[model samples]
Target chain A: MDSRVWDNRAWLFVVPVMAFVLFSSLIPMMTVVNYSFQDSMGQNSFFWNGPGWFQNLLDPTTAVGARFQGALLRNFAFSFTVLAIEIPLGIAVALCIPKSGWRVGAVLVAIALPLLIPYNVVGTIWQLFSRTDIGLLGVALGRSGVPFNVTQNAGSAWAVIVLMDVWHWTSMVALLCYAGLKAIPDAYYQAARIDGANRWSVFRNIELPKLRKVLVIAMLLRFMGSFMIYTEPFTVTGGGPGEDTSFLSIDLVKMALGQVDLGNAAAYSLVYNLITLTVCWMFFTYTTHADSKDVA
Target chain B: MLDRIGLKRGDEVHIADASLELHAGSMNVLLGPTLSGKTTLMRLMAGLDRPTSGRLVEDGRDVTGLGVKHRSVAMVYQQFVNYPTLSVYENIASPLRVQGLPKAEIESRVARAAKLMRLEPMLKRTPAQLSGGQQQRTALARALVKQAKLVLLDEPLANLDYKLREELREELPRIFAETGAILVYATTEPAEALLLRGSTATLREGRITQVGPSAALYREPGNLDAARVFSDPPLNELALTVSNGVAALADGSRLPGDGALGALPDGAATLGFRADAAAAAVAVGGDGRDPSHPAFPGTVAVTEISGSESFVHIATDAGLGTLVCLVEGVHAFEPGDRAEARLDLARAFAFGADGRRIAARPAAAPRREPVPA
Candidate 1:
């Protein structure tokens, strides 16, 4: 056996990337951790608070605590609600896309256009579109004699935000599902037909089961994106109407930049990060476990 | 017991017509070459696709308008049909579940099918856990669970190895006998066609060329094409000229026969003979110099020896191309050797320019079935 031929040179190539990631991610994360546990009052003068900020954030009475808790609940509800609607809608659209030719290409392009738009730009665009004065949507609603204010009403604001997010991100789920549908071998459908499966049965037994792997991926990605929704809602509503439309990220920004409470903001940010990571972890574990059982 | 069924497809095509009748408790094999409409015919029978102008009838009832689920036909595709995400048990039980069968019934059927396929130990294992042949058996078990009256096997064993193919061949007939369901299987291999040896038919260019017993079709083909297709080493065809009560081979040697050439053509005619037919009365002489001998001198062009017999390709002196003959054992004959071949006049067939038999000679034995309707 020629053990000397084994390559150790790959690590040398990976050294720069490892160093870059450490500087870009690990270093900033360390600074956030340091600020989380300490209170720096002025001019970089720091004192150890020993979990004082954590205690305050968990109290549910402080401004940071109230804003964080409210936003967390709202975000969780929004993500799940959006997920329930978008996943099925995406799969339906994917199923309708033809398998080949210019028509499929046109559909792919149309579905992908919204996903290509920058997130902040999506928020700004939706903000303009929801304006009561000049926006077409607002004018159309006005003509219908309905109260069409998105900026002043928290419910209307949340509705617009959810709709906008669905318009922008549902295509991603559809595209993933479309790719999955395309990869399904035609033999399965033929067999299903021969086994005397009707359309609904075919969809339920064959298509859905086969799409399980892709559906999991779409679900996880959509969940994480919706849970961490910040830029679009922030630009569209600016967290107005007494913190009703405000999410965790919006509250985090208010703590760090508005009140200049870096320690509390860092603690809030850490807690926010933990929540997103935990939810995502739970989703991944649950889906993978269920899939394994199906496999078994 | 699977009740008898019937189907009809009157789809017009540029080449040939298509119509098939499948009976319950009988296995029907669809044999054809490429582009012979075998798959299309199978799909129509399975109710996967509709015909332009045809109806499928079962037990004297019109079932053409019914969807696949309404019809009770199960199919095993050439590609394995196990649900990739589901375990072996789940895959087999799916058809039963679709029928809204009781869970106990589903369990019993799945267990029986799995046991028959030798997959009981791997019930909880997914499709990826099994090999290709095992996956195929899982698919077969799934179809069995469906309990459909007609089992359509579309080239089921096409992708298997030789040994697996033989094993499955023996197993498939057993299953068919046990279920007593009509089996309509498609295959391209002539050897596999012999395996069923049932009511077999050859579909060519979208039409049925011949339908009869496998052995009968093999022994006496109605036309030259059928004979050429049916034989193992194909029947040899050569051009000949018959003049004034004497039929001469293309090599200019007269075929020895005491028969009149009635209404014979003046110019060219096609002569046919199977390779295994024998020739006698060879005279030892220079290139066909012995006029009294019945043999014609030809050069042995090529020889391919296979264990018990050999295929000899010979070119005669009359400038005809290679003629193939099956000779017994190995013969030490090189290319360009002066060889004398005696004609087997009794086995020879003569056809006119229109590709129809011209000779009124009686066959070796009585042919069955009113000249093949």
Candidate 2:
């Protein structure tokens, strides 16, 4: 048996990353933890609240608790909706892209264009692009006799938000899935053909299973990205048409910056972060477990 | 008929006018070197790719326009492409599942194929957990479970180790024989072609040069390319002068004209000799010179000894460059040793300027010459 040499010297290479994380992440996180338990009055004077904010935030009777529950439920619904539409749409687009040719590069560049735009820029672009009179989509829908006013209608507001998110981020999922699809050897496709498998059968047996790992990653990224969505909806909808599209991040910002409720916002932040982390961890664990069972 | 069928990528032809009739229940080999269109021809036959011009007719039905999914064909690739996420059982049952076969029937067929490939123990394991040979076996089992009318194995044993290749090669024919599919096996190794002993079709440079029984093609290749394809270690070719019913070597030795050479027009020709033929002549006549047969003196350039056989490379003065002679057991011929190899004119092949074999020579007698110890 070969024994590994004990080398303390290798730890030196890790020191820079550890120091960066300490300054960038741990310090800020500790500040949020400290703020979650204390109430701040004028002139930065503070008194211990001792979980008062957490208890009120957890309850549904108070205004803060009610807002938290509404935002949390809306966030879950929005995340599930985005995943439902984007994952399949991304897979379909990925499958439709040609396997080889000069067109592959052109198509990939076109798909990746939306992802390169800044979040606020994407929101501003969509905001102008969906206006009732001048915006192309709204004007076209109005000309076609459809009642489409994102500024006044809750359904229209949700529609525009979901549509904008899908248009901006589905390409990310497609690119990830395309990378996974490209890794499969041509031999697999050839073998599938020779096995007399139909198109659906081929996709079901070969392509989908091959894309499972990439799908998990796409799901987690899209879930977290859509759950914490603020700038796009805030810029385009302004959490408006009566707080219809206000997700958790937008509500958190409203409570902390707009209402100046520092203690409650801090508690909300910790709870929100915990919820996202827990859900993502569960998804990761489930997928990895399924993958291990497959190999076994 | 693949009358005008060819494959061209941009401007270059991959397989040009490749037409052949394959029979059912007999293994046919597409034997060629690398990039010689063997796999292309197999793909065309299996309906995986359409010919640019020609149509494929199977049992009097034109299948050129039909896709692979519409055809009754199965294939085993060189890379052992099993579904990585699926167990061996599901991989084998995949085609049946596509057909929507009854679950019980699919299970029984999978079990049968698994038993035939000796993969019953690993039925529940995924391809990633299996060895290379086991993965190939899983692929073979998948192909067998389909029981398609046509089976194309594209160098299936090429990626396997030596012993595993030998073992699988022995079992391949037995497995296919029971399925009654028209099996088309492709390989670059001449020894593999000979071992499979199928009706071999020799291909070269996107053209089917010759088609015949494997042993017959080995014994009488139709052209220079076919001879090269069927020969291992390559046949030794010599540029010689034929004048007045006699072939004269560069070393000034003359071989009397047989019936085949008697009809030649007395000009330059190519002489082809297998390694074993050269060794036989060298073994019987130690001095590498025999009066009754054409012989030449040469120095050994290189020697390779493998197990019970030794291949001695000889650089002859006959303007024939180097010739490799496979001597049986062991010989004491080292590099730079002076040796002579006699040519049995009757057993040798002659090609004209166009590289087509001149069939004028009578078949040689099967008598072994005595070693004059």
- Tens digits of per-residue lDDT for model 1 on B252-322? 77654525234566667776666665331222654633332235567887877886887777776667665
What clash pairs does model 2 have?
A: B5-B54, B260-B360, B260-B361, B288-B340
Fnat across every predicted model, in order: 0.58, 0.67
Candidate 2 TM-score to native:
0.82
Per-residue lDDT over A61-172 for candidate 1, one digit per residue giving the tens place of the 0 to 100 score: 9876777789888888888889998999999999999999789989899999999999999998888888888887777887888887887787778888889999999999
Chain B TM-score for candidate 1: 0.75
The numbered model that scores best in DockQ is 2
lDDT string, candidate 2, B182-233, tens digits: 8899999999888888788899999999988887788889888999888888
Give the runs in model 2 whose Cα sits over 4 Å from its true position.
A1-10, A42-53, A142-147, A283-296, B1-11, B52-71, B82-111, B119-135, B234-306, B310-350, B359-373
Residue B216 displacement in candidate 1 (angstroms):
4.3
Candidate 1 has a TM-score of 0.73
For all candidates, state DockQ relative to the true structure.
0.30, 0.36
Please report the candidate that would top TM-score against the real structure.
2
Q: Candidate 1: where is the Cα deviation over 4 Å?
A: A37-62, A98-103, A142-148, A274-296, B1-15, B33-35, B54-66, B82-135, B145-147, B159-163, B215-373
